[model samples]
Target chain A: MPSQAFAPPAFADVLAAAARIAPHAHATPVLRMRSLDALAGCALHFKAEHLQRGGAFKFRGACNAVWSLDPEQAAPGVVTHSSGNHGAALALAAATRGIACHVVVPENAVAAKLAAITAYGATLHRCEANLAAREAACAAVGQRTGATLVHPYADARVIAGQGTAALELLNAGIGLDALVVPVGGGGLGAGTAIAIAGVSPSTRLFLAEPAGAADTAASLARGARVTDIVPETVCDGLRATLGAPNFDILRAAGAEAITVDDAGTLAAMRLLWQRGKQLVEPSSATALAAVLQQRERFAGLRVGIVISGGNVDPHALYEAGALHGARA
Target chain B: MPSQAFAPPAFADVLAAAARIAPHAHATPVLRMRSLDALAGCALHFKAEHLQRGGAFKFRGACNAVWSLDPEQAAPGVVTHSSGNHGAALALAAATRGIACHVVVPENAVAAKLAAITAYGATLHRCEANLAAREAACAAVGQRTGATLVHPYADARVIAGQGTAALELLNAGIGLDALVVPVGGGGLGAGTAIAIAGVSPSTRLFLAEPAGAADTAASLARGARVTDIVPETVCDGLRATLGAPNFDILRAAGAEAITVDDAGTLAAMRLLWQRGKQLVEPSSATALAAVLQQRERFAGLRVGIVISGGNVDPHALYEAGALHGARA
Candidate 1:
C-alpha cells in the first residue's frame, strides 16, 4: 500500500461502510442507567458496542474491511497486526465470509486474547513485542500468502466502518449534546467524529485518553502525530499510539481530549459493572470516567458515551482484585 | 395476608401483569450467542433479564406488585423480606411510584445486596438468618408502618409480574423447544410456567436448581413443598425454600428440575462473561449449566434460558477469586 492511498475517509465513506457491514455487524443497543446518570449528573446514553459481535466495536471495521475487498483479493484472505480485539474481529469477520485470515501477534499479547483469535480460526504469526517486529511479521505473512493487509486504525475503510457505531447512535434520535469515545489507535474516535459531523453537526466530539498513554492528547495539542510514548495503563485496549490518518481526522474534527488516570478508569469500570450491570473493560470506562471527572461540562446534558469493548480477562480481574473494595 | 389468598396465578393474571408492568419494566432482549450454541449443541435463546431494571427479573414482579396496589392499599407503601435481588428490586419499584419501601434482610445477607437496597432508598431491618426470623421481622415492619406485605415469591401479583419476562421471550417468535429458569422460591419458575402454558404450550418448562439448594427438585419429586434445607452455595440468590403456591403451579405445569452443582454454575458464569460477554451471576448461570449438563436432552433443540440476574458483588467476586482459572 502506498502513502497516497491513505487518504482520510469522508462522511460519505462512513455511509457506504454502514451499508456494506449491515449484514455482518450488530446494531448494538443504546442503554440508559438512571443510577449512572445520577452519579455523573448527566443523562448518559451508552452505545453498547461491548455487546457487539466479537464483543467490541472493532468488529464493524474489521467486517467492513474484509467485505470491501474484491472477490479475488478476498480469496487470498486478509491479514493484520494486532495484539488485541482487531485480531479476533478480523478472524471472526473472515470466518463469516469463509476466507482465510492471518494475525501477527506480539509475544507479550494476552493469552486469552490470543485464544480468542485462534478460536475464530485465524492463523497466528508470533513476533517480538514492538511495532517494527509486528509490522515486519505482518508484511512477511501477507507477501507469502498474497493476503491483503488491513491496518487496524489507519485504513480508510476501517475508519469508515468504525463510524457506523456512531451513525447508529446518531440515528437513535437521542440528540446528544456531546459524544465521548476512548482514544486508542484513534479508529473509533476519528470515525465517530466523521459520523457526528455528517449526522449531527452540532454534537461535539470528545476523546477519552488514559493519562498514562496520553499520546493522542499530545498529538492533538501539537497539531501532529506523536509516536514516542511507552504506554502504561490498566486499559490494555487503549495502549496503542494514535495512527497518522486517525490523528489527522481527529485533529481536523477539533475533537477535544479528556485524560483520566488509571485510578479513575478503574473506579468507573467498577461503577459500570456494579451499577450499570455492564461488565465492560477499563478502556470502555475511560469515556464514563471523563464525564464523571468533568461534571460541570456534562451535567444535565444528554451525553453519548461509546462503551468500546468488553474483552477483559475474567481470571486476571479476579486475581488482581481489580474491582475489589467496599465501594465496589 | 391470609394463606387462603395465595391463589396460583393463571394465564389471565400474567396477561394482566404484562399490561400493568409494561410501562415500568424493561422488555429485555433475547440474545443469541453462536459460540454458546455450538458449545451446548443447541440453539440457545438467552432472555437477558440481567439487563432488566434493578439488574434482575425480580423487577418485573416487584414493579407489578407495587403498581397493582390501589391508592388506598398503596398509601403506606410496601415491605418485604429478602436477602438479595428482591430487596433492591422492591425498593427500586417503590421509588418509581414515590412510595416508602422496607426490606427485612437476614443478618447473613451479602453486604453488597444490603448496600443496593439502601441505595434504592429502602429502609433495611436486620434479623436472624432464618426463615422464621425473616418472616417475623417483615411482619413487624408491616404492622408498625401499616405497609402491605409483598412476599418475594408467594404473592399472586408478584408471580404474574415474573411471567412477563417469559412472555416476552415466547413472543420473540423463536419457537423454543424448552424453556429453562432458575428456581429459588420459584416465583420466576412458576410465572414462566404460566407464561409457557398460556402462549407456547408446546415449550417444555425446566427448572434449573442449585444442588446445594435443591428444595424445588425435592418438592417436585415428592409432590409436596419442602422447607428443611440449609443451603450452601455461591449462588446467594437461590437459597430460599420453594413457596407452596410456586410448587403447586410448577407441579401442575409438569415442570422438570435440572440440578447443577456450584462448580458447574461457576463455570457457566465464566462462559457467559467470557464468550457471551454478559456478566451474569452464579444463579443465572444455573440455567445455562443445566442445558450444558443435559446436552442429550437439549441437543438440536431451541432452548430458552432466562438469565435471572446480574447483581453479583464485584468485590466478593474479585477477592474470593470466584472467576479465577486458566480457562477464564
Candidate 2:
C-alpha cells in the first residue's frame, strides 16, 4: 500500500499552503449571480476555480505539492498518471520550478487535455487505457527517474493546496451558511471541509457527486467505502475512487454527500453559461446542480459553490446539448 | 437631424459617469494572457467588459444616459432603437432606476438578444428590419410616451459613459503603450481617444473594424465619413454608421483605423476562447485581430484592448466555425 504515514491535512497546513502557493496560484474571484439567487431562493457565492491557472483548481494543489518538495527530491522531477487537469497543472508547476515532469497518460485520454499537458512542456508516456497499465507505467517511470510521485488527490500537500480556495472564501468575509463542492477522489471536498471546520465552524459542508459515479454517496449511505463500482459519468474529472485518508477526514468533518444525475449536472452547466455568464465544466456544475435539485435544503441560506474547472472541449459540450438544455 | 446642441463628451464627463454608475456597474477585471502575448509579440491587457452587467460595456453608456437625466425626465422613462446589447443595457439600467424602458427592435434581431432585453423588463416594440423603421418606431414611442431618447452610441452622455471603461484602464496604473477598441458608431473609439488624450496622451489609440464593414477605415482614408457603405460583417455590434461628433473627436485625437477580415476576426475570437478562456463576441475580437493583423504597429508594446460583450448564440458561433476557425 502507498505510504499512510502522513496525517490528514489540517487547517494550519492549508494556511501554510496558501502562503506557499500564493505567488503562483491565482486567488480566483468569488462570483455572485442575482438571477440565479432568485431562482434558487438563496444567495449563491461561486468560487471561480475554473478561472484558475491551468483552467482548474488542480493548479493550487499541484503548485503546493511541487513547492513542498525538497530541492534534491524535486531535482529528480515528478511523475503522475493523469489525462486531465492535474497533469497539466503539475506540468506547469514543474516548469515554474524548472524541473522535469513525466505524465503517464492513457492512450484514450482526451486530445484537448493531452494537448494542454504537452503544451505545458510535460513529457508524455502513452500507456494502455486502463488503471492497471497507467499505475504500472507511472511506477516504472518513478523508479527509473527517482522522481517523486505526486498522487493526484492522495497527497497531503495537494490536499492542503486545494483547501486554500475555501480559505479564501471564508476569509472574504462572506457569511456562507453552507459550502458545496464536487467530490472525485475527495481532495477538494476534504480540503474544503477542513478549511470550513477550522475557520468557519458553523458552515455546513456538502459534497456533490454524479449519480452515474455515485460511489461517494453510496459510501456514506453504507457507512463503508465503496470501491467496486465502475464509473460512468460525463464528468470525466470526477471519476476517481475516493482516497482513504480523504474519506476519513471528510467523514470526520461531518460532510454530507449529494448525488446529481448527468442531466441535472448538464442543465446546471447550461444555466451557469447562460445566466451566470461563466464557462464552467459539467463536473463543476454538480455542486450547483445538487443545491438546485435540493432547493429546500439551501433555501434562504447563503451558500458557497466551487466551480471546479473550465477546461472543456467546446464542440463536445455543444454536441452533447449541454450548451443548451436539450437532451443529448 | 439628431440634436447637436450638447458639447462632445470630455474627460470630466467620463469621470462623472464613472461615479454615477459606480453603485450599479461592475468594475470588470483586466485580464492578461501570457500565451497570447507570446503569440502576438506584444503585451495585451484585456478589459473584460464582457463580464459587465448586461454582458457588455454598453451598460456603462446606458446607465450613464439613464441616470444623467433629471428626476422628472427619468420618470417619463427612456426609449432606444437597438437589437443588441444597448437595448438590454438600457432596460436593465432603467429597471435599476425603477423606470419604464421601451426598446424599438428590428424584426430580424437575434432572438437571444431580444430575450435578454425582455429579461431586463423592457417593453419591445418590433418594427421592420430596417434602420428607418427602427428610428421611426423609436421616435414614435418617445413622442407618445414623453420618454427621453438615449441614442445607443451617438449621445454625449453615452459617449462619456463608454469612456469610463478606458478611464478605469488608465487609472488601473498599468502603463499601456497604446489602446485599441472596436469601432462601430465610434462611441467606444472616441471615448477611448478622449480618455487617452486627457490622461495618457502618449498612449496612441487605434480603432479596429471588420473588413466587411470597413467604412471607418475608408472614411479615415478619404478624410470624410463614409455613410453610404453597407455593412456585411459577422460583427453585428460594429455595423452601425459612424456618428458625426464621434468621427470628429476620433479624427481630432489622431486615432488610426485598421481593418481585419471576418476570417481574421473569427480566428482571433477562437484563439481567445481556447487560450484566453474568455467568451467574447466577434466585435470584441476585432481589437485583438487588428493587433495581430497589424503586428508592426503594436510590436513589443503594452496595449489595452476592450472586450466588448459576451452575448451570443452558441450554435450560431459554432456553426459559423468561429469556434474552430474552419469555414462555415
Candidate 3:
C-alpha cells in the first residue's frame, strides 16, 4: 500500500505555489461593478474561476497534487473519492502528468462529470451511498494497486494550491476591503483567508454557506467544528461539512460565515448571468446571495467574490430553472 | 444627418487593425480535440468570443470604432443601428470613455440587449421594423444628436477591429491549417480572412451560414452582394446579408461559405455546451456546425472556429425546449 501522509502547507508554501502555477493557471478576469452590485449595495469584483480549465477552480489543486508527487510514488498513480468537479479535475490533471488515476464515485453522480473523468483516461470505482463505503473503497483501492491516496481537502498540497486562486486575485493589484467565498469542506476558504491575511492585513474574510446546510456557520457559532446535517441546498459543491484542519485555520484567521437559502442562491445566479453575462454554478453564486440578502454590511466596501465553476449539466440547468419557475 | 459615409474596410486596413486592437481584446481561449472531434473525425479549436465583454465579440469592433475617433470627431458621441450586442457594447464602451451614445433600435429587439444599452447610459431611439424605416430613423436620430455614425459593420474601422480577433488567434503561437467563422454581414469573415492571409498564407478560410437565411451564400453564388433576403434563421445575429463592401472583400480573399439548417446549429450548440462546457450563442455554433457536417473536408488536420456570443435569454431557452417538446 502506498499510503503516505503529506505535510501541511505553510502560508509561505502557498505563496510559492502562486509563483509556480502562475503560468498554467488563468488569472481568471475579475468582472467590474455593474447593476447587480447597485442592487446589492456593494462594489463587487468577481473572480471568474468558472472560466478556469476543467470548468472549475478544482483544477488548480488537482494539477498541483498530481505534479507534486515524486516519480517513484506517482508511478503507481493516485486515488481519491469525489462525485463532482474534483473527480473530473483530478482525472484531467493526472492525464496531463501521464499518470494513472482512480476515482471512487457514488452511482448517482452526474453522467457528464463521469464522462469527463473517463474521457481523461481515469479508472472508476463505484461505491455505495454511505461515507464509510466511499472511504473504505478508496482505502482498499489504494492498498490493492499501491496507488497513493490524495484526500481532496484533507491533503495540504491541494489546500495550498486552491489558495493560489486568492493569491492571484490579491496580486492582481486589487485592494478588497472584504473577501467572500463559498465554504464546503473549508479548503478554499481556509486557504484563501491565510493567503489574504498574509498579504493584505486590512481585508476581512467571509465564508458563504447555504442556509439549508450551513454546517460551517453552526460550527463557527458553537466554537467547534460540526458535521452530519442533511444538506438540501442546490449548491452541490458546498455540501461537505468543514474539514477539521480547515476549521482550525478559519478559526485562527477569525473569519465569519453567512448563509443564504436556495431561493436566494438561484436568484443571485440568475442576476449575475443576466446582468453580468457571466455563467456560474450555484455554489459559486452563494457569496453573491449572501451579499445581496445581507446588503447593509457590505455597503460602500470593495468586495471580492469567487465564481468557483460552470460545469452544470444542461439537463441539470433545465431542472434548476424548473425549480426557479416553481419558486416564481 | 450624422450619417457621414465612412470608407469601407480594405484588406490592408484590417491588417493594421490587427495591431491596433491587440491589447484591448482577449485572444479568447481555444479548446481542441475531445469526444466531439472523435465523432466528427477532425480536430476543432473553438475561439470563444462569447467570453468577450458585452457577452459578444461585437465589443471588439464597437470599442475600436468608438475609441479610434479623432478626439474631436468622437466628441458629440456615436450613433449605431443595432438593438443587439453591438448596441450594448458600443453603449458600454462609449460610457467608459465619458461620451454620449445614440442607438436607433427596432422596437422588437431583445429586452435584455435593450436593458444593457440603457444601463450603459446610451440614449435609445426606437424605430419601426421595416429596414428602410429603421435606416431612416437611424439617420434622423444621428442628425438630431450630432453624433458620429458608427455603422455596425460596413465601416472600415469596425471591420478591421472585428478582424483583430482572428489576428490574435494566429499570433497566439499556433499554426492552424484552416479557419472557420460564422458569417452574417460577412464582416467577420472578410476581416478574419484578411488577417489570416496576412499571417499564414496557406490557411484556408470558410464561412458558416444558417440555411434559413443564407443571403451571403446566394450573394456569393450570384457574384455580387444582395440584401433583400427574408431572414428567418433562429440565429438572429446571422440575419444580416453580406454588405456590399464585405462581399467585395470576400470575393478578393477567395473564401468559401456554406449554410447549415437550424437542427445542425442546435446539435453543434449542444455539443459545445455539453462537451466543451462553454456557453455561446447560436451564430457562434454555426462555425462548428460546418466542421461537424462537412467532416470529410477537414479530416486529420487542425481547425479553428470562433464562438461569437453568449447572450441567450433564459425565457427563450425554456420556450425553445417547450416548443420542441410540443412538436415531439
Candidate 4:
C-alpha cells in the first residue's frame, strides 16, 4: 500500500473541499422525528447522506479526488477497488470531469451497484471473492490502464474530502450533542471525528460497527493491527478490515466504538423504513442500532446519525425480512 | 359538504407560520441535482418534504391547523379522516400539545400507519373501506368524543399551513422557473400555487396526478367538479376525489393538471430508488413521473418538484417494480 500520513484532517480541509465541489455536491438535509426521538430517549437527528450524489457519502471524496487529478493523469483517469458505492461515486466524479475510470468490483457484488458504475461510464474489472484477489485485480488494472489508485480510506485527500459532510451538518447551525457514524474502512468515522473536533468540540464522536465485523473495535483494543478476522455481517459496506492510516487517525480521535448484532441492525433498518420512511442500507442502520441498543446512555442527549447509503437490493430486503413481524 | 368561500391567502400568513413553527418544525433543505435535471430535461430542484415530520408534507398543514385551533377546542383535541399521512400528522401534532386526538382511519390503511397513529397518543377509530364510511365514521367520532374535526385538505387553515413548505423553499432563494406538486386532496398543490403567485409571480405552478385517478385533470378540463372516477392507481395517497374548496383554489390560481400512467409512476419510483437513492412514497413519485414524461415542455428550465412523502411499504415497491426498468 502506498500510504499517506495518518494525521487528522483540519476544519480548513473540509471547508476548502466544500468550496471546491460546491457546484457539484449536494448539501444533504438533516431529518428529525420527534415521536421517534421520545422512544430513543434522545433528540435524534439523521444526516441524510443516503440521498447524496452516487447515493452515498463516498461521492464527496470521489469528487475531490477525481477533480484534483493532474491534467495528464486525468487523461489516463482514476482506479479504485470497491464492490459498491465507492466504485459508482468515483465513476460519476470522473465522468463529470470527462475522465476515464476503471473499477475492480467483486463478482458477487450487488448487480444494481455494478449497473450504476457502468451507467456512470466506468469500465469494471470483475474479481474473485477474496481480499487477495481484489487487491491483485486492482493492481493489474492500475498497471495496465496507467490509472492512479485512489485508495478508498487510506488516502489523506480522500479523508479530508470525507470530512465535508460533517462540515455541512455543523454549518447548518444546529447544536447537536453527539455524532454517530458507521465504521466501514474508517474514513467516515475518522473524518467525522476530526471535523466535529474542530467545529463543535462538545459533540461526542461514536463509531457503530456490525458485530459480525468488529475489526475496528478489536484493533482499537489490541493497540496494534489485527487483520486476520473474517467478517460475516449483512452490512457489506463495513466488511473492510480497518485500514492502517484510518486506524491511526481514529485512535487520535479518541473515538468511542459500539457493536451491534446483525439482528439489531435489521431491527434498526426496519424502524427507519417503517417509522422514518427512509430506505437505508444496513451500514447506515448500524448507527441507529447503537443508539437503540444503548438508549439509556443516549437518553436526553441530542444525537446525530449519518444515514450512510441506500444502495440495497430491495429484493434482498424482501428475502431477509418480507413477513417479519412489525413489532419484532 | 360544508365549504369555505374561494379566497387567496396573504403572503403574511406564510411568513407568520414560518416564524411560529421555526422552533418546532425543521427548516427542510432545498436539494438540487444536475443528473435529475438531465433526465427530466429541466434544472430540477427537489424540496424534500419526504423528510418532514410524519414522513409527508401533510405535517405542515396538520401542525398549523392543530396549533392554530382555539385553546379550549385544542384541549378536547382534533379528529380527521385519513387512511395515511394526514392521520399520522394530526396524531403527532395533537400529541405535541398534550391534547386528546381521535382519528378515523379506513379499515384498509397500512398496518404501519395505524401503529404510528397509536404511537403518537391518538385514539384510532377504524371504519369501512369506502369514502362515505370514512367521513361518517369521522363525524361520529367527533360527536361521540366531543372533538374538533381537522379536515384533511379543504380546511382553510390546512391550506395556509401547507403553503409554508413553498414559502420555505422560496426562502432558500432557488429561483425556479416552475413548481410541480403531486395532487391528491390538493392541499399542497393549491397552497403552493397561491404562495408562488404572491411571492414569485414568474414561477408557474402545476399539479401532477395519477392517470388511473385523474379527477383533477378532468375537472380542470370540464370547468367543474369530476366525481366517482374509479381510482385504480398504486399511489394510495392520491386516491381522494378533489375537495370542492381545493378545486376552487387551484382553478382560481390557474394551475394546470398533468397525469401519468401507473407504469410511468413505477418507472419514476425506480429512478428515485436506484438513481436518487431515495425512498419516497408513490404519491410523491407522481410529480416526478409527470416531469419525466414531458421533457419538451420543461427543457432547460429550473423546475421545483416537491417530494411529498416517503411512507412506502417495502413490499409494495417490490410488488410494483422489482424487475422493472425505468424509461429515460
Which candidate has the highest DockQ of all? Answer: 1
Candidate 1 residues A1-328, lDDT tens each?
Answer: 2122887889999999999999888888898887789899999999999889999999999999999888988899999999789999999999989999999998888787888999899999999988899998988988888899999999988999999999999999999999999999999998999999999999999999999999999998998888999999999999989998898888889999999998999889888887777778899999999999999999899999999999887557655767555244
Q: Where's the lowest-lDDT run of ten residues in candidate 1 chain B?
A: B319-328
Q: Write the per-residue lDDT of candidate 2 for residues A120-209, one digit (tens) a residue.
A: 999999999998999899989998888788889988988999999999998899989999999999999988988998899999999999
Candidate 3's docking class is: incorrect
Per-residue accuracy of model 3 over B255-312 as CA lDDT, tens digit each: 8888899888987876666556555677888988999888889998788887888877
User: At residue B54, what lDDT does model 3 achieve?
Assistant: 72
**Model 4 per-residue lDDT tens digits across residues B191-303:** 88768977898888889999989999999999998997989888889988888888988888889999999888877877776667667778888888898888889988888
RMSD vs true structure, all candidates? 2.2, 2.4, 4.3, 3.2
Q: Model 1 over residues B42-100: C-alpha lDDT tens digits? A: 99999999889899999999999999898987889899998688989999999999999
TM-score of chain B of each: 0.97, 0.97, 0.93, 0.94
Off by over 4 Å in 4: A1-19, A107-110, A326-328, B1-23, B72-75, B105-112, B126-146, B316-328
Cα lDDT, all candidates: 0.90, 0.88, 0.80, 0.82
**Can you rank all candidates by DockQ, best first?**
1, 4, 2, 3
Give the number of the best model, judged by lDDT: 1
Q: Per the 3 Å backbone cut-off, how many clashing residue pairs does candidate 1 have?
A: 0
lDDT of 4 by residue, A215-291 (tens): 89998888876788889998988988888888887887788889999889988888887767666888999999999
Local distance difference test, candidate 2 = 0.88
In model 1, which runs have C-alpha deviations exceeding 4 angstroms? A1-4, A326-328, B1-4, B326-328
